[model samples]
Target: MYRILIVDDEPMIRKGLQKLVEQSELPIESLRTAENGVVALQRIKEERPDFVFTDIRMPKMDGLELCQHVAEMDADIQVVVISGYGDFEYAQKCVSYGVKEYLLKPVSVKGFKGVLEKLIRTKSKVSSESFIAVTLLEQWASRMEQAVWMLQDAELDLVLDEIQEELKTKHFKLNRVVDMLAEINTLLEQRLNARDVYVMQRDFDLAGAENEEAVWACFTAAIHGYLEELKAKRKGKLKDPVEEAKLYIESHLAEEVSLEEVADHIGLNPSYFSQLFKQSTQETFVQYRTRRRMEKAKKLLQQPQWRITDISGEVGYADHPHFTKTFKKYEGCLPSEYRQQMGIRA
Candidate 1:
């Protein structure tokens, strides 16, 4: 369906023209009517109509003046003028403005038919690519909310499926694109859930340049809240050994973290502590500690003052190469690359 703009000062004339355009065989699905040339220019820029029709003697601006301005603005549009007179001199001036067709009113049925017939043959072919771009925009909007939901559910495969379903009307090749984004979101989620690192970054962004203290304060509040929620859910309280062992590991995240040390801290056997931690967090104690440390490593990388080796040591990894490999295991990209992205955005 081609876009058509009606530029006439008279309300009745504009409405009649719009209705006629929409009723035409060429499928004028997006027809808009503007009261004057000023309004017509605004509509032209916004909707970018392929075809325009205007009366000759509108108040504040006339048809020939509008034609010249439209050419100066975007010469691609097709302009047809409607005049209440059969004046040759006015037509001569309009020709210089690139006015394709001039009609003498009252607009006979035969005249509108000719104008639309020509538009179907010329304007439709010119706007096909733009129409496809618009359809793709429509598809993205249609998928955005649902895609976000699928990601939050940890359903990465479901996200791609939803994108394919959403673009069924447009038949867009969105499956691979959405799949890649889902993978990124999964990594981001892992980091977010690990010691609340992503939440800290989000807080920093929201708190602004002068509010570093405020960001930290918010993070502290969220941590207290998460702890309180755990206390409230007595029925699903974490495995027995985790009650003390996990707390020990969190405080000692910058050291050579050991399950045996954590078990000794909590007065539990090391093997029992390991199994209990997995039952509580759905991850082995070592994997959980590594993930949490990598999350901190990413946050440390955000600061300009920290070196990668220093951050790696600070996050409890005794071996720098080992830290790099594990960070890559969870974050897809290397720590340095992630830091580069943070700096670029900053």
Candidate 2:
């Protein structure tokens, strides 16, 4: 849905156009009227309407002036001039200011529909492109978050470089790029906050930046500073990675444990963490986690009040049959069979 603002000095003309637009039914979410260009421009700034229908002659500011302002302010706004005059001079002037459509005097339904359909087509195309950019930004931001937690400076730089290249090649609008950068900043800030990292003061105004380069620089600089802080903290207080992984696994026995997550939690490379874990414990990380989970499952299974399916989930297995199979393999008996041997039933 789109919002439209109708600007005209005459009240009757405003109502007539509003009625016509409502009758046309072109996906307009809102229909607003302004008595003159000044009021219309204010509404345009505040509302950021998708379409602005304005008359050429008006008090305080005319349609020509409004067209120029809209062009300077935001080219995304579709400005349509509705005037009683058939002057070529007026049409040329509007064209100079990037007015999309000029409807002379009374607007015919057919002519109005043609202009509206064209504008909607253009807006849809832009919207689809913006969607792709947003999706890519989100995916990259998630990867960047993981890299930050894992203290992988190379991975972080690689993700940011890919994002920068994508923005340049795609030629996304500066505002859209700013919005994407803001989203990345928010994600990183939340992740940092979760780990009790102090977020640096943000002095840069992303939206007010002069150009895309400046915006990208601001984002990358902030991320670099944040990464440096993480590095400093890691160096100042190094913990045993294997011990941390063990603690993490113990807490998350009821959840699916992954080596990568454990490595990230301990700020070590996943492969290095896996090797260190094996060296330290004489067992692979997966083997240790499975043993811990089975130990926990054994205790839970011993309780006669606990159901077998519930016991399965209590130790991270969501599939009851798979849990039973694994339990039989490890204990040489199914969970129910083990319970029966212990003089229990479910």
**lDDT for each candidate structure:** 0.62, 0.77
Q: Candidate 2 lDDT (Cα, whole model)? A: 0.77
**3-57 in candidate 1: lDDT tens per residue?**
7898999988887786676556666658888888888877765555667888887
Return the TM-score for candidate 2, rounded to 2 decimals: 0.48
Question: For model 1, where is the 10-residue window of minimal lDDT?
Answer: 200-209
Q: In angstroms, how far off is 323's CA in candidate 1? A: 53
Q: Worst lDDT window (10 residues) for model 2?
A: 199-208
Segments of candidate 1 deviating more than 4 angstroms: 86-88, 125-346
lDDT (0-100) at residue 172 of candidate 1?
27
Whose lDDT is greatest here? 2
lDDT for 238 (candidate 2): 62
